[model samples]
Target: MVSHGFSAIRYETEVKTNGLSSVLMAKCQGCHQKFKFETSPQLLNNRNKSKHYDVNVRAVWGSMATRGGLAHLNESLATLNSPGMSQQTYTTIEQEIGNMWGEVVEEDLLKAGAEERKIAMEKGQFHEGVPCITVICDGGGVKEHTNIHTMRLEGYANSKGTLPTQHVCYKNWDESSQAMESNIILEGFLKAET
Candidate 1:
């Protein structure tokens, strides 16, 4: 016997009459029986007719991903939805349940990121007058506001213009870990030639 999961159900006429009572209807996997369950109005509204999962919101999320790290995603989104920008309507930033960001969007973003990195690398390359690309590597540690120690290695290339070409970072949990991370970054830079 195949145990298929419950299929989604749509309520047609009773939506307004029931205060949108029933959110889901599903068929049992084992017995193949159908059932409907009452859910919270919030859940029903958010799941059935969510403004958060629309295309424009998704496009904004993609924009946020390109701007920086995930830590800043919500902050940037909130700023975008501030009073001045409220008329634009980018308020909903919640991830949909069981929904994945599709590969088409992901692939497009990945390609764009790769292109940006390539352009930055090209910009870092030495132009005329300088015989060779001046490769500079440095590593250091910083104590963050959260009191966590983080170590990072920065690589720069100079010709006519000086630009950072690479960055590697890791948590410095202990002295030994910090040493190991620094050595790894140093080795990586040494292995790469401009």
Candidate 2:
């Protein structure tokens, strides 16, 4: 006789691309709406991650402050690093500081938000929320070990129409080839969607 171990796994997925697909339903439920559309892919890989760049921006700033040419900039930066600076003033100072520290590159955080908005526009999710298509997968029985896996949508259907979006992301996996599935880390979209 074989004993089956009890197991449960959970994970959240995001619409990386935010685009929609045409889920035509000439017949849905008890109605014949004959609806047609261009749906967006519903998965992490498809979801666009422009906002993530802001994180990079911060990391870059921190790293720059501690390294080479920009190393000395830290002292100057400390003066303006108070917690009481007005939001507006802090932003201006931060950007200036970033530039003065290194290449400066892009400054305004609002501008960064705009960049994310642009990507959301392409996916039609900038305004309207994307719908999630769910599939109950029967994962094999779990024993002393747990495995993680990410599922990417190759195609999708929605109200607009169908189109292919190029993107990929880590959805779920066994956590770095370890049976330690108890400690799951969802840094970004890896987070559970509400």
Candidate 3:
């Protein structure tokens, strides 16, 4: 029998990976509404990008201070109404709940994550949460263009719901474990070839 909390998100998103910036479309599970966006680190670092943009990739995604579990971090904002959450104890939460705020069960999320990682590993998708860096080269199998760009965004199902602060994190990649393995994590973001 399925657990009481076993609920699946009924939503769809359009992830268009063919532009100067990636287009993010999140469908709300609760409201069945569509949310659209186009955010990038370059745009985030752009001072002009602010004042009008609600996202700052550099601030939330591309800094030493921005290392680790970005998806998990973003997931927290969904439950900001709660109390007693801190970065220092992030690992603790990651281990106990593993992004309950992200609208996924621990075990189900584990499998989905594994599927993503496997696909990335097999097809050079770069690991999830890796920083996307862009560089311009002059020669030697290089060109005068940026070489990387990685972005992370959390989508909602539109339905108003509650999320837990608890989480689960794995120190290393162990198929036997249900937490985020070390190999699955990188200190930076994933670079997009340009």
Candidate 4:
């Protein structure tokens, strides 16, 4: 007679993680079988040719949305008894995000400039054979003695009531807050000339 044997097999599990993503790996002691499971998909970073977990990028993005940094993210993770990312990893992700934003900002500025020029051309607003768009400058700073200042330049639609103002330039000033407006205006005009 043939007899079937029943036995309980043991498996060892290990977790590997990056940021909010984790991978569960298991190995069967008897059969030596291995299995792996991922909590998040890995994404490719085009600029650096590196791979990153999707959740890791999302976590950094969420931190940036709240204007927080690595410390803040770590604090939140610590409360949940989760491991925090290394500073080097955080910096790499932050730099990648910053680079992406820089490209977007440049594209937006170019589009805004193009739209302003088109509006000026349609209205026949020309000076010395160059299309001249009306630009409105505004600046503000803290009420206190802080020297920090911010300025924005908007392309005004003027007589065209249907068209809204388009932002052309935004800049931060390190000089006296009171004097920032004039400086920013001058800088805006200089930039337009080029």
Global CA lDDT computed for model 3: 0.37
Q: Candidate 2, residues 12-112: lDDT per residue as tens digits?
A: 22222211122332323333234443233222212232122232234334533443212233344456661122223223334444445443333454465
Q: Over all chains combined, what TM-score does candidate 1 have?
A: 0.18
Residue runs of model 3 more than 4 Å from their true location after superposition:
1-11, 18-20, 39-194
How high is the CA lDDT of each candidate model?
A: 0.40, 0.34, 0.37, 0.69
Q: Of the candidates numbered 1 and 4, which has the greater TM-score value?
A: 4
Rank list by lDDT: 4, 1, 3, 2
Better of 2 and 4 by TM-score: 4
Question: How do the residues 1-194 of candidate 3 rate in per-residue lDDT, one tens digit apiece?
Answer: 12457433432555753212346776655566778766543323132332212233222333223344534444554466422224433332232232333445556756865676676666665435643322333334422221111112111222335442332322233243322232223321232122
Worst 10 residues of 1 by lDDT: 145-154
Query: In model 1, which runs have C-alpha deviations exceeding 4 angstroms?
Result: 1-47, 53-59, 67-94, 97-100, 103-194
**Candidate scoring better on lDDT of 3 and 4:** 4
lDDT score at residue 51, model 2, on the 0-100 scale: 26
Q: Which window of 10 residues has the lowest lDDT sum in candidate 4?
A: 146-155
